[model samples]
Target: MDRRLPVAVSFMAATIVAVLALPLELQLAVLITTPSAILWMGRTTVQHARAKEDNLRRISEIEQTINEIAGEELLLFQSRHPNRAETVGGRTGMSAVFATTLNSLLMLLVCVALFGGKHGLTAQILYFVFITAIALDLIMGAVQLNRYVYRRPPMILLEK
Candidate 1:
C-alpha cells in the first residue's frame, strides 16, 4: 500500500480548511508561505532519495559478503538500509510537495483576484515581495527536483 495516499489527502484537507479559515490578509500570507514550505519539503525528499539510493548501491555492492553472514546479521543490515523505507517516504514527501505547490498557487491566484486592486503602498510592497519570493522558491525547488530527475533517464525510463 502507498502510505503517502492518506497523508496526501489529509494535507489537502488541512490546507483547504486553513484557506477557508483565514482572513483575506492572512490568507495572502499563507499563500506566500506555502510555496516555500513546499520547496523545503521537495529538497528534503530529494536528499532522502539520494541517500537511500546510495545506501542501496553500497549494500548491493557487498551482497556477497552479506550473504555469507548469519541470517540475523543480514537481516539487521537490511533493516538498517533505507531501501523500501526510502521509496515509501519519498512518495509521501513528493506528494506533499506537489499538493502544496498547487494549493499555494491556487491561493495566490485567489488572493490576487480578491484583494489585489485595492491595496495601499504597503500592501503593494508586501504583495510584490511575496510573489517574487514565492516564484524564486518554486523555481529553485524545480531545479533541485530536476537535478535528481535529470541524473537518471533524460526522457526514457523514469526510475525513482
Candidate 2:
C-alpha cells in the first residue's frame, strides 16, 4: 500500500529511461541506478519507520512499573548491578548502516558501470558485479535475520 507504490514508480521510471533514450550507455546507466535508487528508498522508509516505533515504545515504557517493583530504593540498588549485554549478531543499528553505506558505494559503481558499458566490455561485467553484490548482501541479511529469530544454536562471530 504505502510502500509498494513508490517502488513500482521507481522501476517504471527506469524502464521509461531505457526505452526513450537513444544512446545505449546512458540507457544502461539509467537501468543500473534507477532500481537501486528505488529499492534504497523503500528499504530506508520501512527500516526508519520501524526504528522510530521501537524508540517511541522504549521511551514511553521507561517510567512505568518496570515489572512488579517493591520500592524506589530497590529499583535504585538494582540499577547499579552488573547487567551482561550480549550482542548476538551484526543485526542491530549496524544493519541499516551496512545497507545504506553499501548502496551508496554501489550507486557510485553503477555510475562507473555506465561509462564502462559504453566504452568497454569490462564495464558491463562490472555492472553485473555491482548488482550481484547488492543482491548477495540482501540475501545474507535475510539469512541472518532468520537465524536470529529461530535461535537455532550458539552462532559464533569470528573476528579477524
Candidate 3:
C-alpha cells in the first residue's frame, strides 16, 4: 500500500468539502482523519519497535549471517543510509505539520472572531469541532516529533 494514500485522500476530501461547502461537521471530521491516522501509524511503529526488541536475539542472528557475507562496514553503511533517509523525511514531515498547525490556529481565531458573537447553534458546534480537530492535529504532530527526535538507533547486527 502506498504510505501517502491516506494523506492524499484526506487532503482531497477536505478540499472537495471546502470547495462544495459541505456540512461543517463532516468537513471537520474529514479533516481530522489524516492526523488521527498519523497518530495511529505512529502507535503501530512504536509497537513494532517493542516487538523487535523482544525478538532482538533472533533479529541479530539473522542479520549476522548477512553481515558476515556483506562485511560489517557494508552493514553499517546500509543501516546509516536508512537512518539518514528517515531523519530527512521526518524533518520534512514536521515542517509540513508546523505549517498546518499555524493555518489551523489562524482558522480557529477567525472563526471565533466572526461567529463567536452569533449564537447560531450549528455555527457554534462547528466552531467547537474545528477547534477540537486542530488540537488533535497539534497533539499528533507533537507525538510524532517526540518519537522522531528521541528515536532509538537501528539495531545493527555488529557493533563498531
What's each prediction's clash count? 0, 0, 0
Model 3, residue 145: what's the lDDT? 47
What is the Cα-based TM-score of model 3?
0.39
Off by over 4 Å in 2: 1-20, 49-120, 141-160
Cα lDDT computed for each candidate against the true fold: 0.53, 0.47, 0.48
Reference-based lDDT, residue 40, model 3:
50
- How high is each candidate's TM-score? 0.45, 0.42, 0.39
Point out the higher-scoring one by TM-score: 1 or 2: 1
lDDT of 1 by residue, 1-160 (tens): 1344346446644664576577877866665555455445445544554554455545554664575674535544544555434442245445555554564456445544544545577886777677667656755664454345212223486799
Query: Any residue pairs clashing in model 1, and if so which?
Result: none
Ranked candidates (TM-score, high to low) = 1, 2, 3
Q: List pairs with backbone clashes in candidate 3.
A: none
- Candidate 3 regions off by >4 Å? 1-69, 75-78, 81-89, 120-133, 148-160
Cα error, residue 108 of model 3, in Å, equals: 1.9
Which run of 10 residues does model 1 get worst, by summed lDDT?
146-155
Runs with alpha carbons beyond 4 Å of true place in candidate 1: 1-21, 64-115, 118-122, 148-160
Per-residue lDDT tens digits of candidate 2, residues 20-139?
A: 454875666666666576456545543553454344334334433453364344233222323211212223434443444454445444455444545468866766677667666555
RMSD of 3: 8.3
